[model samples]
Target: MHRHKILVVDDEHLIRWSLEQNLKKQGYDVLVCGSGEDALRLVQDEAPDLILLDIQLPGMNGIDVLERVRDVDAEIIVIMVTALGVLETAVRAMRLGAYDYINKPFNLDELAIVIKKALESHDLKREVDQLRSTQPKKFSIDSIVCASDSLSRVLDMVRKIAGSDAGTVLIQGESGTGKELIAKAIHYESARCDRPFVAINCAAVPETLLESELMGHEKGAFTDARTQKKGLFEIADGGTVFLDEIGDMPLSIQAKLLRVLEDRVFRRVGGTRDISVDVRIVSATNKDLLAAIDEKSFRGDLYYRLQVIPLLLPPLRERRDDILPLAKQFIADFNREFGKSVHEISARAEMRLLNYDWPGNVRELRNVVERAIILESDEVLQLEHLPREMLSVAGTSPASQGLNLVLPADGIDIEDVERELIQQALDATHGNQSQAARKLNLGVDAFRYRMKKFKLL
Candidate 1:
């Protein structure tokens, strides 16, 4: 839980103070200096994890300082702080080994996001460097565990696609099928892992701002356009831009996105200059784009363009062979996370997990295992540890155990039910906390926390 120390190098005292306060508020240790010379001394003295150096510094310009910093310790991450229309300097700073550059007068929220991403990238880089001689890749087809032939075939396709330089890939699947996971596997397994891998959910943003989000906008493009901003496409140049839920992208923006796919260039909103990018577009969606085209909501040409290499992730129900394996893997993961000793699923629990339809797929399965691990203390996971819904959906229950807890059709808060269960266990055990905890198969600390939460102690 070491707090990341951020060094703020800005000639303007207000900017330095503002950055320091904001960074400190975000739980980051902050160091501030006005000159690049002083910044270098701080690098040697404080050994800040990251440096936000202003391009317009008073002396020993930010570019020079960045070069010297990299030369001294390439491990230290440096993000350039630029002003409006200083594209050339930012690009130069990038070439000189700056991790990223943020514009002045930036939104604190966006700046926080940038800093977080830079640090994450720095950590990944260090990990990769350390494991270069041993680990082949952090992301690979083998990372996904599945024995189902259906998934195996899909992975075979992914293997071929990852090695190829195909630009536009369309991934279609049902909800909870891990579309973004597939996207990342493609990106990190390819040559673009070192560069930025930016993703934006097309359905998450409003139609009014999707254009600016993709292509960026000039400082005064619109009423709220306070400064020039880089979009996902620009940021992901020479890397990958994952457009999640691309079927939800509006028609107007769809045409522009198609143009970028076709020509590899685009202009900023309200700007005449063409900004070229060499990013691979990997888009995914749960919607049927062809049907959207039939309804005239989506562009037919764009649909064809996006599906240059089509990938379909089959639903969990369809891949029944993968269900048990995936559940066991999730069980192992939750065991480590929850500090539980649960090692194996009971025969009845396995049957229930395999028989019940996973409407939420892998995500739902993970949640189910997490909840079970939280409530289970035994080395073996039993049927009663699962949610009651599983029995309801599977049309059976472990009746021999002689436990009766029926949830109403209208449903009740799970927390309320948990409190009632804890109280009942305590009552049955004559208020002996250890016996009550043992009766519920819950860890002593977990059982006590619930007791406190329900005001039972």
Candidate 2:
């Protein structure tokens, strides 16, 4: 939908006119300038995506204009227009940052191809700039949303330590508790944010390849080591390297990692000299490292080295208060993704969400909301939009298997007791109208009438 702008800079009248006509037919906004001075002015004003610059200009040469253009916007794509005799000048222009060059008395087809490639490069550069601009916002402290005080305290700690010069950080949490997100936030918030953030899963890599992955290897280190390779630590020298699932890392690799932590130097698998790097290590794990050490699967010294600052993330079940807020955030996200009009979740649906224990934690909750958004057609999300597993009687314990409660000396009212039982059945069944009715041993229609009378519908 976006129309690209092209600037044609040439002293020859016929060439400029031909280029303008052909480019206009190709759906580009064409601007023509007779000399380098006019081209510089149009660049400052129109800011064209691509420039077709003639090598021989009257006032200032095209290469001089390009040098000035670089000072203004280095990313501007410039294609030098040269004659056959001036081919050497075109190569010199390329060295000064010209994107590509086309021969004068050029084929229309060849010129079109060069213009297309330049525009594609320009678009890719814009996309990269946009991504670079948004990276800071992605890892900012305000990006994460939570409602519980437990998570609040955790995020507060993340804020305090994110900017510190800590050597090693260990994050421990169940799967789907957002440990990787916290790790990224720490890196982006630190002084090394401008550098790279490299991550590797210690459990995902095989033991044979894991050592080579953490430490570079010489060309003849192994059968597959055909060339000298830089490991993650070397590649992320001035940045943060996230070692995910570190508890599962093999003992052989752990010894090598320990050396890097202690001496800040490591040798390639078969290399003679050591390579020293200044890197901040942030490792995460779902397993108990202390238990792994006790079992002799993990080294005790490596465990202590990695846990210089330990961060424990509580599972979603312990933070019930965050359920609705996280659900709402997911709803907004899916609305944009699915192009839906759904806005609010019904209060009864909220109660069902609160009642169910999130065994899979936040990841399960996100999937549930995504599924609900796909199935929903109404403006408000209702209980029926939820998955059958969430609404089934299997998700809740039956009344006969309920908790033991002691009654006071003044016994509860009989009608009040009946109302409380109905509420519990509804909660357990996740607000399933028919299932709750069946659990209370009543007809569906009768149950609805009773629910209306008690204002529980």
Candidate 3:
């Protein structure tokens, strides 16, 4: 690893010498300059990671040097050195993008603390930039594995529409059906793939804060808005902003969102300036927006704008052909994750997977596969290795595949049967109550109530 370089620019010889010695001892490649002109030259020639600049210089002052340094390389970390009473100039330097400032006659320990912070921030920025550069490949279309024609057609549609100029897209799907994944595919396939892809869930954030989260807020706009914030739309300018669970958005915010869709201009909260952003809007929801509009909870105009390129993701049961393929993918993923050698799914296991009603969709399938992979030690996933509920289905006769319900000659206990089924689901999920509840198509509270009554908790 290369050592970080630090440049100390000061007209005073003692201060520059002291800083250079201390920084050199700390394994930094230290460079020194007497005047602002010499400092600018060193900034170009040395290209130091950080510059400890003195506010009082002979020819060109430190403020001028800081501005010019930014002009040369905006990313270079600069810390202003100021006298105790020269705070006003230091504040101005901060506005010019100084990382932080230190008082002259500064404690060496305090200076060290500030320097450590600035360097860490510089490292984080580089890592983020690297991740941003590789995001397209990470979210590429090939990342989504499916064997069904319904998904294939949807992928084809994604490609066709990705090249369009700023078309609004609305993706509708059942919960856990990979709606966000589809949104990412559309974004990564588009012309603005290199830019940011900001996502926010309308349902996740509180209603009171959702508008500010989308449109940004000026400093002191509200009680807790102490600092200016750039919202999702502003941050995702020239790219895509994915509004997830858009059906749950408040109607008041819907009107604001509609204004943005109609005219790409929105004023920040408590601000007069209309900020314009060229963001592609891609909204997703599991709820029926038409139903919402009929119920007076959603805006019809916004719905029309959002549905310009509507993409519907079919539920897992409808696309039974993809279940085994998705299972195999999950097995491969878990093998790497858990360091296991499980390879193939048995024919019986596949049949059970195909027949079961996936109420929670793909996400549920992934969890089930992960659970089996973690529990089973065998090389192949057999019927016995599968979940108990799945094994129950697999064991039933071919005639009973469609409907396995048969009234016993001696009337069976219905409560006992319900408890047994719930127990099997809980066992299948390794005591994960939520997954079990989803598998049974019961609400979490209802499932908990049953578990409590059965003493399964």
Candidate 4:
């Protein structure tokens, strides 16, 4: 938002000199040019926030410069400077998007006022643009970061699904497994990238209003229907409409939805006309739609129609190889967000991250990293930064959590169970003793003694 550099363009030496001195006094980085050609070059090089342009210049007058400046960057604030009695030319300058104009009688106070207001307005605009630019990085198949083969296969499926003209897509996953992110990746990777991508959660809306929400209503359809409206399908025509939590959509709406899917046309809530749309319906649900169908809550016909291209997102715990990589990616994001220099994850913290079964999936991991980055002020992320719940769960066995075991009529040896567990850990880690010890939550010496006792060396 800080208005840094400015370029002053005029044919007169005194006009340029006076304006340069004034702007410099105001703590602005000032660049001055007398001719239109030099002014253009300075604009291209300096990329100034504001330009003080005179209407009469050597080659290609101020209006010409203003027009070309717009071509290069339309956001630059321009204020025209003209001689007295040139109202017609000044009017022409305004038409070319000049912010304001100052006449011959150099009123420093008035010029200062114009520049201050213009830059303030421009600063507001730039701040809004900056906010829009920093929104969550758009999801595309190429932008997804992962290190696990399980997820790699899922992403590979997504890549093929996106390239094809598969109109109906059903993303199935556990809650917080980023079903919507996968849906966006498919839409953005496809030819519909330039069109709108709208989303609505079927569970969040009431069953009474869900139909009206998805398939607009004509006026007088209901008491609240004050006017005709365009539904998500119509609004997202030639694009995509992401129906999150489609399993919760009521059966009545499901019947209507099946018609839309089959025929590519739908009737408004109270209208007879069939409004046709060409939107890709991307639905996602964490629930077992097949089970819902068995329960008769979800329509089987709709389920089959919707699952034309079924995409399954693997849970985060199943993709443990990606844990550390995703954690680091979140760390980098939070470092920029919180202005911290946290770069390393302590060994113990890494072990904790790799051990926990994140029922909440990637969303939980992102939140944990964000919390750690906000609270940890050091260069490394450590165990102390973790939530209390995570601390209690890390490296803890199920038996330690009060899980009871029933012994058979003939009791078995506990040492044999321990030995078998140790062997499995070693095999899982491919004989890396240190990692095997970590997996068993034992010290290297303790594991070595067990190895010697069991003759596992």
Estimate the TM-score of every prediction: 0.59, 0.69, 0.60, 0.72
Candidate 2 weakest lDDT stretch, 10 residues? 401-410
Show where candidate 2 strays beyond 4 Å: 4-124, 393-457
Clash count list over all predictions: 0, 0, 0, 0
Worst 10 residues of 1 by lDDT: 393-402
Residue 363, candidate 2: how far off, in angstroms?
1.0
lDDT of all predictions: 0.84, 0.86, 0.87, 0.85
Candidate 3 local lDDT, residue 349: 56
Q: Alpha-carbon error at 362 in model 4, in Å?
A: 0.5
Alpha-carbon deviation at 424 in model 2, angstroms: 8.1
Instruction: Report the alpha-carbon TM-score of model 2 versus the true structure.
Output: 0.69
Arrange candidates, best TM-score first. Answer: 4, 2, 3, 1
Candidate 4, residue 245: lDDT: 94
Per-residue C-alpha lDDT of model 3 across residues 1-457, encoded as one tens digit per residue = 7689999999988988998999988888999989999999999898999999999999999999999999989889999999899889989999999999988789998998899889988899898988976777778788898788999999888888786875699999999898999899889989999788999999999988998999999999999999999888999999999999999999989999999999999988878899999999999999999999999999999999999989999998878778878888999999999999888875445555766777889999998888888998988886566656554423343454555343332345677567767766776678899988987889999999999998978
Better of 1 and 4 by TM-score: 4
Q: What lDDT tens digits, residue by residue, belong to model 2 across residues 276-360? A: 9999999999999899999999999998988889999898877877888899899999999999988887654665676666778
Which residue pairs collide in model 4, if any? none
On the 0 to 100 scale, the lDDT of residue 362 in model 1 is 80
Ranked candidates, highest lDDT first: 3, 2, 4, 1
Error of 4 at 146 (Å): 2.1
Per-residue lDDT over 65-151 for candidate 4, one digit per residue giving the tens place of the 0 to 100 score: 999998899888898889999999899888888888889867987888888889888888878887654432457666677888988
- Candidate 2 local lDDT, residue 401: 36
